[model samples]
Target chain A: MQDRYVAYAIDITDPDDPRVDNFRNLTNADRRPDRPGGKGLVIGEGTIVVERMAGTRFSPTELLGVPRKLNELQAVLQDKNVPYFCASPEVMAKIVGFHLNRGVLAVSPRPAPLHYDSVLAGARTIAVLEGIGDHENLGALFRNAAALKVDGFLLGPRCSDPLYRRSVRVSMGHVLRIPYATIDDWGTALEALAKYDFHTVALTPQHPSDTLADTIAVPKVAFFLGAEGAGLSETALRAAHRRARIPMTPGVDSLNVATAGAIAFYERSRLTEQQAK
Target chain B: MQDRYVAYAIDITDPDDPRVDNFRNLTNADRRPDRPGGKGLVIGEGTIVVERMAGTRFSPTELLGVPRKLNELQAVLQDKNVPYFCASPEVMAKIVGFHLNRGVLAVSPRPAPLHYDSVLAGARTIAVLEGIGDHENLGALFRNAAALKVDGFLLGPRCSDPLYRRSVRVSMGHVLRIPYATIDDWGTALEALAKYDFHTVALTPQHPSDTLADTIAVPKVAFFLGAEGAGLSETALRAAHRRARIPMTPGVDSLNVATAGAIAFYERSRLTEQQAK
Candidate 1:
């Protein structure tokens, strides 16, 4: 299915058609992926995101877009056996329950969950997140991780579903490409990191502490990042090889969690460059 | 208004009461602080933001919040001639046109904007933004600037108002405290940077370019950050003392504008620490 060369544009004139049910009422939480009534169908929105989905395990089962967007994405659609459900902008709005400015979307079945080992394989740098419940933050972290060269994500606990529609959209579809796995017990995850020869650093806001500059030069490291308010749990903190702050101004609150992560990731690439020289 | 010890808890039972006009119909863009009918009032939401306003020039004309939130802020409110307009949650929601989970809001007339001279004076490591129109990015950049020790912002043409309601809220009210100036002409702004002995670096995604690590150590420096797609103009690039790229994984999109700024800010502090050592 990943190597086809034809575009099948199916015209969708009615909003209530069952064939296009996957794209309906996206704003409703229950109908969105991972929600109670939803079928755990992963969704990719916009032309760029739809193109990104072509490179991931979360293949687009079907695509919905206006004719113009479908025509633009014809090359990308060739690889998916994509049944492009073409609709006028008005029909698309009614089907989605809102006017999606991106004008294109794709739906996929949630792929089987990967284990920690699969995520840890060949990973030199990773983000082990604790209690990251906001979808935007979760998504932004994935995007930052992708750009800054973080190998993957090891989910600790209380993280929102990374493949949720909003997360996929916010991540610019990188969540589907960068691998992740949820290891329920923090202790077990720490053991796995150790087994994988990964040096672990827990990122915290507490200052007068060791800064990232003090500890980021190791060849293999996993930076553990926590949520905004309540930071890393005691188990997560105690298990880490070391704790480091991102070196912030005195008296100011910590940088946004995702921003802090970007700084950490950027530092890794930077220090790595310095080392190579 | 900056120095006082009084809290006038005015009870506002009716949402339509003209006395609390500043906080009413807040969802409508026209009624928002910087909009046409908004009178350019700088608004700070939540207790932390409202408290942060006390330290900035945007003095609160009055405050509207539920009794519980008002009581929580009583000690902080003592610093201002704060007329704490108290109302129930339902009444407050009706007044603001949404359910405010933070439950507190402060409104202040937008103070006269600072000029480049005032913002650039005594500054080191500032973010000179060009064409950043998103309020959230503007607000996040301010918050990042504050947390990461960026001294101020120099706004180029096409930038949005940092004093917008959403920007204020997103900055956690740091938008009110951090100084910024709109320097209309790019050439003049470049000359001013040079006049202040600032080594200007235009941040861009183009590779084989100098990295932030190459030039962040100068005593006085300003990083020119551009919008996401249409990055810094050729004129901005040519004017800089150097051009720096925040090192990233190739082929991945550049980091979000605000996140990139944070990395630059973090690099400054890290290098400064190294210099001290």
Candidate 2:
């Protein structure tokens, strides 16, 4: 008898196969993996991200890949009963509406988003993002957070969906691992943060703010970051307990949002790690 | 008789105008601004970068832009005698082989490369790269270096040119201002760094390495960095005065090369600035 996975593997010779429709024309805005029929659907590109999807709370419903990648992903797929739509690279390219060198894809339904309290509980250090609309920046921030040991993210208004395909891929699948929640209002979030005994500091370029180094000693900290241009809104800045700036050379534009967040996280990690020692 | 400035501004209705040939089909490998006919050509995109080019050593030989951008650049162009090839957006797009929303492009011949000693002089902190092939990352490093006040770059083997159009734009034109030089051999470059009283430190993810903060107190520091995956070459690592790492969470990949460099530069900047006080 053939193994169970042998039965689950379906050959997809035609790009138009309905069985693989979920992976089709991915560049289209409406059918984006992040949104299907107004609901969220997560897509992971490449073996690494697909493995991340398999390992996380979001188990992929199906997979599309060339034979090489499918074979490589055997260990990652052993625990799941998801169907593998094996296709040629050319057919895969046709379905995806562009050439994807990664050679593998995984699709999962986006789950209910986490709540602020759920994500904040027991977390010592967290990052709060405001108006970070760029998906790549959102993704990079999560990647940096994962590497620097930030516990979670609390997103304020105008933040883009972290489950978007580009975000997932750019985060190198770390977005799947780093828990985050969206806040309905900055005021409520700030109030909640205060109750948690967290020191909330806004990262901005404005002078008269304390340097990030001087503000990193608090036990529970949530560093707030904003988009590149039109930085944190006046409301977000005024509401925070403190404002801190990453000192830099004069005459240069501020660091990229993701880079700025990474620096803050690094500084926090360094000082806190040393304090523990 | 019209003013001399009016004569300098030439209107072009055709995409194939020979006068604007240097800006033609810029996306093509042969016509790429970074390497045209095997000689370096620096290109600045958008109004901001072109304005930067105007103020730097790389003055634009000619400019191609729409009426609005041309009018905006009048002050920048006042001192220069370069011809302005004004065209409609559609015509400009056709000539460039793509829709460039930047609305303006400037081309200038690359100046002779600087020497390692020249870029290394009077530098308290500097960043050195080995085998960094990504243009965007290279550009971002310069952007970060400029912001953090790193002196300049001493490029080892396999670094991509920062004068590429994409790098210039990604760097927000900071690449044009930041001085960099290529080296023939890593051994010779490290020797020169030693004589300059530079304490060379390799930033890697390797274990048993000193934390960046521990190594930040050196008088003249040169941080050596490499590409993301294949880090600094074994030879370069062994030759460095010290090996250091930015403390990161377990099992997570190291930060992006550019981000890592930024943190190193930031740490050096923070400590040095503190010491100065």
Best by lDDT: 2
Q: Residue by residue across A1-277, what tens digits does model 1's lDDT show? A: 4422256778889899999998889887675445577788888999888888887898788988888887678777665566888898999999999998999999888888998899998988999999999999999999999999898999888888888889988898999999999887787888889889999998987643588877878989999999998888888887888889877777787777899899889888878888898
Can you tell me which runs of candidate 1 are displaced by over 4 Å?
Answer: A1-5, A31-35, B1-5, B31-35
Clash count for each candidate, listed in order shown: 0, 0
Query: Which pairs of residues clash in candidate 1, taking residues 3 or more apart in a chain or in different chains?
Result: none
TM-score of chain B of each: 0.94, 0.94
Expressed as tens digits, the lDDT of each residue in B1-277 for candidate 1 is 3322257888999989999888877767675454565677777899999888876797787999877776677667776776889899999999998999998999887777787889888997788999999999999999999988889999997898888889888898888888888887898788778788999988898855798878777898899999998898888888888989987888888789999988988888788878988
* DockQ for all models: 0.86, 0.87
Docking tier of model 1: it is high
Local accuracy by lDDT, each model: 0.85, 0.86
> What clash pairs does model 2 have?
none
- Once superposed on the true structure, which residue ranges of model 2 sit more than 4 Å away at CA? A1-7, A32-39, B1-7, B31-39
